[model samples]
Target: MHRLEQQFIDNQWVRSRGARYLPVMNPYREEVLAEVTAGAPQDVDDAVKTAQRALPAWRSLGGAKRATYLEGFAAALTRRREALVRLSSTNNGKVLAEAAIDLDDAIACYRYYADQARRLDERQGAAVSVEMANVEARCYHDPVGVVGLITPWNFPLVTSAWKLAPALAAGCTAVLKPSEVTPLPEQALAEIALEIGLPSGVLNLLNGDGEGIGAPLSRHAGIDKISFTGSNRVGEAVMAAAAERTVGVSLELGGKSPILVMEDADPEQAADWVMAGIYFNAGQICSATSRLLVHEAVADSLYSALEKRIDALVLGNPLAEQTDMGPLANARQRETVNGYLATAEQEGLRVVRDARHRQLPSRGYFVAPTLYRDVPLTSRLWKEEIFGPVLCGHSVANEQEAIALANDSDFGLAATVISGDGDRARRIGRELRAGSIWFNSEQLVLPETGWGGFKRSGIGRELGPWGLSSYLEVKHVIGPSHG
Candidate 1:
């Protein structure tokens, strides 16, 4: 068992102000694998003060120096990738393969931002001609002081890397409050940051739930910006809390993303994409394609392929090399998903797949993958975000119908289009109201591309240069020029 009994503050692993502790459980085993200090509002205040104290020095260190630190940090991640993967699997309950991807993505993100940081000086100031003869204008991107970053339980370290990397690269000091349910991975990350010699107060980690740290962090006057990733419910609270200070906030909220399978698409490939989109990580992912909008002509063939694919999946211990999927991260998540399933049944949706249909272990927070077809537009299964290994399928009469159903969600985080014709797929992708769209493929978030959503999915982007901009405040300098 692991015990992360201290929070990282002011470059030290210090005991929390509160004596309470939270147990970190392995959802696959349904047992406590570790314990972390449960930080309180005072802890948030201290971390914020420390980060605020360190911001000026860290930002003055110049982008190039920050780039060097990041590159070194990426190297450190490579050296410890396997350990991180195992910790992630144990703490977050994702399969080994998925956990590995989290570590790999974190490494790639840090490297990508390291390069961006190096070019920060070049990208900063842009000279512009002024209407007044004696005046000259230029714009610069400055660091957004102390930032409070709240990451979710799913993809703990990778999500932290998405926010923390850019925040640091943009020359901002940070106080990261990772999900209390999955604090182990973030603890390891904080250790790595200290090992790499990140300056004192540059990066502080506070382990706690929303009341303990998230709410307080968002409202802290010392925090100049707030970056959060989680359910839309909490994201709303974060926004409201930050409003007290009117601090800059970036939110990557919930999504009910859809996968549109065209009649001309290969049935086998389409089914594979659909399964991966929802069943991977047991459907806890924010951008999980929970809704499957397919052409009526090909729905049967695709469902047949999906049934075969689902039966072959290996659902077991996350540590096993052969395990294709793991349990939900916690019991609360499992109950929430089961509640949605019950609602789906009550709403008269046809169940295409169910847990009883497959052979599986009876322990842990395991909800076998499920699919519901002929789901009406008004059904909760179709309208609400179940956030489980459950897919709500709808048959569309034509391409236009499919597009309409796909864009029906309040969320516009992500959408996938599968079509044999490249131009046709591109045309459909263009029309989808989502931040990220996949054409003739499945969901894949690259480090260089922006990832966020439209409408209620989120307020701002989280990856690429767009992510860096979240931690920066632009300034226009106007003065007399002798040129």
Candidate 2:
């Protein structure tokens, strides 16, 4: 058994003060893979104080110098790529291919942020245009000081990289809390930091559930900001905690995103995109396009095609080469998804594919990829985020109706549009209310583009330049013109 009873703090692996230990399960095998320490509020205080102490020196190093550390992180990750891929697959119950993709995304994020950090040197003391002739003003982007980063169980290192890379690139020190359920993959980050000789207390990794680490970290007086990626309920709690000190906060929360398939779209192609949007990563993505709004003319054909694809999916051990999908991340997630399926049955929604119609693995937390058609807009299945390989959809009369239906949800995280006419798809995509919209394409996310949503989907953005900005505080210096 892999037992990790220590926390990474001040560049040292020290035993946690808390006595509680949580089991890390291999979801595919339905067995305990490791036991990790659950940190206490005292641990949070220690992490924050260490980060605070390190911030001044780390920030004073300047952004260009900081870029070298991020580059080192990327190189270290590249060296351990295969090992991390297998570890994430075992811990997260994602297919080996998807785990590899997650690692690649994490490595790319560090490299991208390294470039951004170098650019920060050029942008330092940038001149600001002012109305007064006698005034010369320049703006500086200072590090936001010590921050608390909380990442969910779903994407492991990927989400942590999204928050941590940019924070470090912006010259900020941080304390990170990975989900207790899937903490195995994230330990690699701390190891990488140590291997690269990242300055002591530059990044602290704490393993615990929401109460033990996340809550206290968010409320710590020493933390200048909190960046969290998780549920809406917890995001609100983090915001409330930040409000106590008027501390900065960046939240990436839930999504019940929609995909619109236009009348002219090919059924097979549309089905493929739809599956990719919702079923990738076992549909645990925060930007998962779980709702489908297909044109009435193609609804039947698209549904038929999607059903066939779902049936053809290979659900088995994530480490296996032939597996297309794996179990839910944990037993709790499986229960949550099963609860939604039960709700669908009570609502009398038409089930195109589900456990009743398909076979699942005999053991493990496996949920059959489910698809429901003719689902009412009022149904909970249509309105809520099931967060599994569950898809709910209905037919719309035209493009306007499709756009309306897609934008009707409380979420605006992501959406997809497919059409034979490229311009038409683009037009429809623009009308949808989401942070990211794709037209006749797969959901390809790059580190250069911003990721966040309008409405309740999230507050502020992550990734790209916006991500770097989240960890910076702007200051303007004004003086008499030299001329």
Candidate that would win on lDDT: 2
For model 2, what is the error of residue 283's alpha carbon versus the real structure, in angstroms, after optimal superposition? 1.4
Off by over 4 Å in 2: none
Candidate-wise lDDT, in order: 0.89, 0.91
lDDT of 2 by residue, 142-221 (tens): 99999999999888888999999999999999999999988988898899898888999999999887778888898889
Mark the 10 consecutive residues where model 1 has the least summed lDDT: 355-364
What is the per-residue lDDT of model 1 for residues 1-483, given as tens digits with 9 covering 90 to 100?
677667899989888886777888989888999887777899999999999889889999888899988987789889988888998998888999999988899989999999989889887778987788888889898999999999999898789999999999999999999999998877776777788888999999998877778888888889898999999899999899888888888999989999999989999988989998999899999999999999888999999999888888889899899999899999999999989878876787787888756777767788899988888889887888888899989899889988888888899999999998989999999999999999877688999999999999989998899999888898998888876
What value of lDDT does candidate 2 attain over all alpha carbons? 0.91
> How close is every model to the real structure, measured as TM-score?
0.98, 0.99
Give per-residue lDDT, candidate 1, residue 370: 93
